[model samples]
Target: MAEAVARTSYGRLVARLARRWGDLSRAEDALSDAFERALRSWPGSGLPDQPEAWLLKTAHRRLIDGARQSGVQARAEPEIERLLDELTERDDPDALPDERLGLMLACAHPDLDPTLHTPLMLQAVLGLDAARIGAAFLISPAAMGQRLSRGKARLRERGARFDLPGKDELAARITPVLDAIYAAYGTGWDEIGASESRVRGLVGEALYLSRLLTELAPEIADVWGLYALIAHCEARTPARRDAEGRFIPLSEQDPQLWDAALISQAENALRRSLKLAPPARYALEASIQSVHAERRVTAETNWLAAAALYDAMIRHAPSLGALTARACAHGEAFGAERALDSLEKLQGQASEYQPYWAALAHWSARAGRREDAARAYDRAIVLSADPAVRVYLVKSRGALLR
Candidate 1:
């Protein structure tokens, strides 16, 4: 409920804070104080008649208090003070939504560490709870709490300005925001736990942020392309695994589980992305998903074509994730030998190299090499920290025991 209200009323909330206090810092101070008031008063009061109005009212009052304490107008920033003074003062009043656009720019600060920046945006601006945020990253809630605290302190020390970046710089900065969200989605999608809320939330938030970016720069194809990539991934999320929280390879997933509506939306997003000429990294990734999407069923999937798509991707981005995805395809199509040859070069590239060894285990089992399978499975079990990897261990060792 809090997240919904925050999302719905974000622009207005941001604006009123700026209007009352001028600039981002005091506005955030006023808003945070108002939030504290909400926490203290709302439970008993049963929510004011108009929550947005109540929040705006509380924010103004807090701004006034802050000004009194600071011995200056909270609206003291000269240019905006006049705008502030022109407003009528009253309890539970309504004002235009805040400039969430500007606030997004502020939140996407290049100077701030990218690691904490996305979570900070989720916490401060979107009002997501720590559990949800932590779940997004596949981390313990305690770890998330500590991380967010450290991030907030760093942001404070840097004293990031409440301003937008120039076009090129803004384009560069937006990538990290999207990257963090993508990282969250990746971990959460694989996580074998009941708490999948964070993954869903972060994926939703990432797409939202990308849309916001597109509005700010319609010419930025990468933004729309990113939207396509995430949307495509999200379209598959509900069916990515099954009821038991096990990893279900896409080949084995029921086609009916694929969300047709999301697929259609993703297709449109991909086309919208092409409007900017040569496609970017996300477009290529989406293109790969598109190949999978275009397939009528798993057997009909173009593994060779998919592998080629990944090869192009590697030439451009050269990440271990891309390399691993291709290796999985190789293992599925030709045999384990081909996959093993492909995975060997990626030893130092990934810390979680267990997936590669797991692939080897699968191939060893397929080749009926019991000893090789057991040894590879042992290495895989050691490398894997995630529970899902245990399934490979069981299958491989079971082959030997049989």
Candidate 2:
């Protein structure tokens, strides 16, 4: 119950508290305290009728106590007074205004390091932990924790506003906001059924943010592009596994299981993005997804088109994921031998990325490099967090032995 509340209401609670208290770190600390209190008290008192309201009221009190105890009451008098004013209005936590977007933008403020923006938004807006955000960025949890602490302190020191920025400022901070949303979605998408990855629930939150962005910034092409890309991916979730819960790669999945409505929505968003601007990073990615969406009607994926979009994506972003995906797409479009050559160039950078090893194993097997395929498959399986994916890799490896 607490976990579910944390997954759903944590961001809303934090956003409200941060705006009222004018301190992101304190907001988070107070909320953490509220959750701890709930854990200790809920078991004995039975579940509260309104968990979010309960948590909010408790956290509000915590903020007041902390401010008074730390000699911050005078410095934070106005915020504290506002908190007290809000204390009487805590009957319906759901009625509290959602300031998550404002909070996210604040985290993306230019004063903060650009690289830290995504991690900060992931933590502040989606309630993701440093460990989970670190996993997404390939940083150590301890190091990520330190970085996040510094980021919060920096935000406070710089006095980043908790309100929405002006149009020009919004544009400046919007890129990292989009990146953070995509990163959050990717983290959740990858962790599907992995028990240790509790943040898998964040996928819905990411989608919610994307939808909100499309409404808030209708003129921004990248926002629609991201929405389209995410919707396209979500549309295929039903087909990603077989009846027995075995993993199914995109090429082999039954397109009949794909959500046509979502594909249509994605296509419409992609069209909007293209009309607004040339295909940039997210736009290029959405185009790739659009090509895959075509497979539902054409009954075949256009690897050449996907490969071309990936090449274009590299020109824009050149992210390891894009590069690795491009290699796999080229392998499908050209030949396994050619694909293996493309992938070999990225071995140094691909060592820790599971998709790279999986693609390498597939192309190696296609190229009839039995030993190399076996080794790559072993590594891919070892790195895979999804049990179904590991099972698929094991089966693929067993086929080599036969």
Task: Find the candidate with the highest lDDT and give its number.
Answer: 2
**Across residues 1-402, which tens digit of lDDT does each residue of candidate 2 receive?**
688899878878888888877889999999999999989998899888779878987898888777778887557667666765675566765776767778888887778888887788878877778887787666899999999999999989988778776777776668888987887675434322242243354567678888878976788889899999888888888888778878788878889899999999999999999999888889898899889889899999899998988989999898777787888889889999879999999998878888889889989999999999999999999998788888888999999989
Error of 2 at 357 (Å): 2.4
lDDT of 1 by residue, 23-61 (tens): 554566666677677777777877766777667666766
TM-score of 1: 0.79
Output the number of the TM-score-best candidate.
Answer: 1
Candidate 1: regions farther than 4 A off: 1-4, 11-29, 35-54, 72-98, 135-150, 156-159, 166-169, 188-201, 211-217, 243-246, 297-299, 330-336, 349-351, 366-370, 382-389, 396-402
**Which pairs clash in model 1?**
11-97, 11-98, 12-97, 12-98, 15-98
Q: Number of clashing residue pairs in every model? A: 5, 0
**Candidate 1, residue 22: how far the Cα is off, in Å:** 7.8
- Candidate 2's displacement at residue 67, Å, is 6.2
